[model samples]
Target: MKKHLLLLSAAAAALLAEEATLAPVSVVATGVEESVVEQPEAIAIKEKPEIELDQVVFQKDLFNSLPGVRIEQTGSVFGHMTAIRMPINTGPYYLFMQDGIPVQSSGFFNHNGLAYTTFGTAESVEVLKGAGTALYGSDAVAAVIDVHSTPAPSEKRTFLFKGTGGMYGYGSGLLEASGPAGEEGGYFANVHYLHSDGWRDHTQADRLEANGRYDLAIGDANALKIILNASKTEAQQADSFNDYANITDRSKAASDDPNYFKALEYVDVKRKFDYARLSLEWSNFSFENLDIVTTPYLRYNRNRYIATWQPNLPANDNELTTLGLLQRNTYQADWGRVIFGFDTEYTRSSLTYDQKFDIQTSGWSAAYYQAGTIYDYDVDYFAIAPYAHLEWNMSDKVVFSAGLRYDYNKFDYTNNLEDDSYYYALTSKGQKAIYYRPGDRTDSFNHVSPKASLSFMPDATTNLYIRYANGFRIPQASRLYSMKAGYETVTLDPETSDTYEIGLKKFFARHTFVDLAAYYMNIDDTITRYKNDNGDYYYANGGSSIHEGVEVGAGYAFNPSWRFKIAYAYGYHRYDNDPKYGDNEMAQAPNHTGNIRLFWTPWQFPGFELMAEYIYVGSWWFDDDHEAGKYKGYQLGNLKASYRYDDHLKLFAKIDNVTDNEYAVMARYAYGKTDYTPGDPALAYLGVEYRW
Candidate 1:
């Protein structure tokens, strides 16, 4: 690692000298007003024209410009999946932000909740590469993506409408309005709805979301901003089946008996989320050079899931709800800035499973229903966390950041039934009822996480940085609720990882750019699920593991009419103990992934644009069996065209998965099953927008 860092530093130095001493023309464009240069490497020297805010707002165009970022659809309108080819999930890789505020759920593996933001309503999406947990939180182990909404103009009220429809009963509509509400106030509101029938059988999803914000100038130096957001999503379950031959044929009937496939399962899921925030800003406080800002906010979220596989029994329901309050204050000084914040989150979750078995299934043919059967079990959980982040500019050429967080969580479980199910109590032949006593269990724990980063600029053509962070994930309620008879309660240890990273950013001429990063992480007590001899599944600590990777992205403009962009990521993971499973890498994580895109604007039509892009994902493991083989690699292509009519009206069309290729973003097999499955089907859409 030391040698690699040294080599990178030497290469950056050589590039800086050649570009600065030999090149006579100015290649770099410094447009970010607040961006401070710390070291010689911090300069962004480029030959291509500067990328303004407007150019980075659109998806097709933006993806074409970023180096290693790959944006693909997960085959559903209400949900999309992004993979960084790293350890982190896509939802956390990109920070979801409304305006400038962060929007995220406060639980592990729930990063998918960021989908609450309606993509149709976004004005711009920003993708920052590399780990960002130092600035965000534990979940940002890969990158930070920020989505910004349009801001209200000062002149007059503006109204915008957009709608899209296409094959497979796919459609979406959005309405937005913004303008000056009064002499010192402005407001913006957006509402959107999306639906898709989905390509696979029994796979459908829909979502409705809305957001509104108001800004008020309280006085000459003070301003207040308020925001409200709400969203609801529901979908039919689409678990994979293991009839390998039938599925491989692609002609199997949708109504085929699912019992033939041991892994076949289905579920119905719904989620609701809402949040509000208020902020106050005082500029020129005490002195014209000083500024102060304070913000306080509240958030709420609820999620519920039900499985329909066991139709004879009541549905299994899992619900989680949370309420939180947060306050932050920032003071700007001449040399640097100080930011202090405090937040409290209270979350509660309920898990219930109702069990029932038919007399025939239980081998009690003489009885109408199995006697002494356990009816229901419930589990409740609570958690709270507090955090703080600080940034300091030690000098004109260097900056530093540090953060700390503490979390506390508690869980409890109870059985509502007085008797054990005959199925569980009876011998292998089911000749008698099993008798057991109802009971309860509880557990709690506390954890602290810390992060640090340093940014340095050696010259106007380069930017260099290094970061370190500690992340932790608490065990889920499902892990505890499925315990077997011998254990009173499942004892879970927190999973933790320590990450280290270094990166360099550079620009050649104004139109060409490159960003590269390398990272390594050590994970302890990694949580993994396993099945016992009786077929009951539970979570267990997987000892230790190591993950390391490199990511690189570059963009270049061939000429005024055309440009090219490419990005690639390579990663490797391995367990450190137990020689057998040690060779098995993490699931769903490919060692190689990348994307390439081309953007064109014909000289004859300046208002019209065209784009084509391709994304590739390498083979990956589905489970811990190193000999189970691997899921084959796959590629996807996309095409987009757009025309602008003045500044207020624009039309666009996009065709995704142009080859109509069948692939899976993630694949899993359980209950002693095997088979690689396809993900979502091909999709296409066309839309128009009218903006004032």
Candidate 2:
């Protein structure tokens, strides 16, 4: 078994070497543009052409082609749990941005926040692995993902329309238009609509998104850009089933399981989300050796969902509106440069939870709840951070960089319920479940993050770098205001991580590129909930953990017609000094993950291309206590082919799960029962495109 798994890793090829070196531009490392090789961080980039080839149906799959990154599908339509240089648990350990601006405020962090942003018109996707630099502050612990939108074209007019369909009642349409607006400006716009009556019994999904951008070339020294996006998504949430039959059949829900409690059925569980954002950016104004940029933005996001995973299936509604600004100035000289920047944001948010119906049951799966509103609160959040970055060229072959940031975060929380109110319920084990509401209060937190790196370019094709960075996540509104029995006064500190990494990059004969990195991260003051001696759960910042991993990405082009690529990562995550589960491996932190792909473009038949990919997910313990056994992960195969029939017409076909294997996208053990979220079976999609 071990040898077989090793072969799987070896067989998973990497991205094209050309893609790695061609058009190499990265902005995530610093707030400014820099080549990936010259940057001191480990970054992976997927260009627009590569994205168009994938014809991605689910946004969660957008970044899986990169090493050391995984987005687990959890049956919540566009929602996912991301793992990048950390455990696979859903925590506020990542920052998602659009065109260098944050999609959501850190005070209102959501693990499934990826759904709040649209990427239908993205020009490129960039991921900075491990801890982020000073340019990014809170919620930049594990990784930072930035999606850059396609800029308006300045030379010509373009229009495109595409339609896609597959089994399981899946269909989608995409329309895009771009052109020069006038002598000094241009505009780009796109709209996407998708629908699917999912393979599962109750997993239908629908989404609509519109994204647009306008650019104005102000004289010759400056430019003004405007960005706007909006999206709406609705989906039925599916429940994980424990029965093997349900998993293999791929047509069952929790309501169909005989062993499952009827009262716990989540057939009607669903979610609705709406998001909109508008931003204005003024950039490229240059004076003697100096450059400046300013961006101001407004964003709104609302979500209403049924908490089916929880007992009694309560309904949760939350919304937030944000006004934010980003300002930066850069001074450049012969010997590197200096950057000064500050970020400010103010947000108003509201949350409510209510149980529409009361249900009670007996036996080992016993549960009880009262039909009434439990939590209603409003929060106002304010944050400001000033940061500076310095770079020095020690020699022609080496560069050094350092940065620091200071952040001040404050939250004013108001509880609609009376102060010290309480709601009670029964747990699965027949114990009392207590929920508490605290009074209005103001809380503030402050932290400083520091980063430094040194890089040496031994030669034009070889580069080496080592760096240390610090990242943190302030307590979210719910963590601070949402209380439970025995935890009325939760004084949680910001969760912080310190990471050290070394990396090497080399190009072999200009046809192969290999990138490798190893990192160690230490997390302090991890936010968690623990049961007291009296059997009551309370939230606190009392946990610590250590994570270490090695990742490699390499690609080789045999010729212009054939290419092979491989990306693999091995990670180890464990508790450092926890009261429970000491030294145990973190739950769901897979030890191994890899991807391999082979691409062919026939020279004889121009515009015809084919690609085959193999993906592997390794085994891991299902629970933190290490008592429920391990879940041996699964592997999948996919094939894609495209034919450019002419300049204005093209066709493509994709086959997923080509082996028709039966496997689970997610599996875990809880309450002495095994639950499995089955992956989809073999499926195919066909699409066509017309461009002018």
Best-performing candidate as measured by TM-score: 2
Over 4 Å off in model 1, which ranges? 1-111, 126-154, 243-294, 307-316, 333-335, 354-395, 408-442, 480-487, 508-511, 578-580, 675-677
Q: Scored by CA lDDT, what does every candidate get? A: 0.53, 0.81
Q: Write the per-residue lDDT of candidate 1 for residues 147-173, one digit (tens) a residue.
A: 444443334677888778776777888
Across 378-445, the per-residue lDDT of candidate 2 in tens digits comes to 99999999999999999999989999999999999999998888877776556564688888999999
Question: What's the TM for model 1?
Answer: 0.77
Q: What is the lDDT of residue 373 in candidate 2?
A: 84
Question: What TM-score should be assigned to candidate 2?
Answer: 0.93
Candidate 2 runs further than 4 Å off: 1-23, 254-267, 361-365, 426-433, 508-511, 531-538
Candidate 1's displacement at residue 123, Å, is 3.1
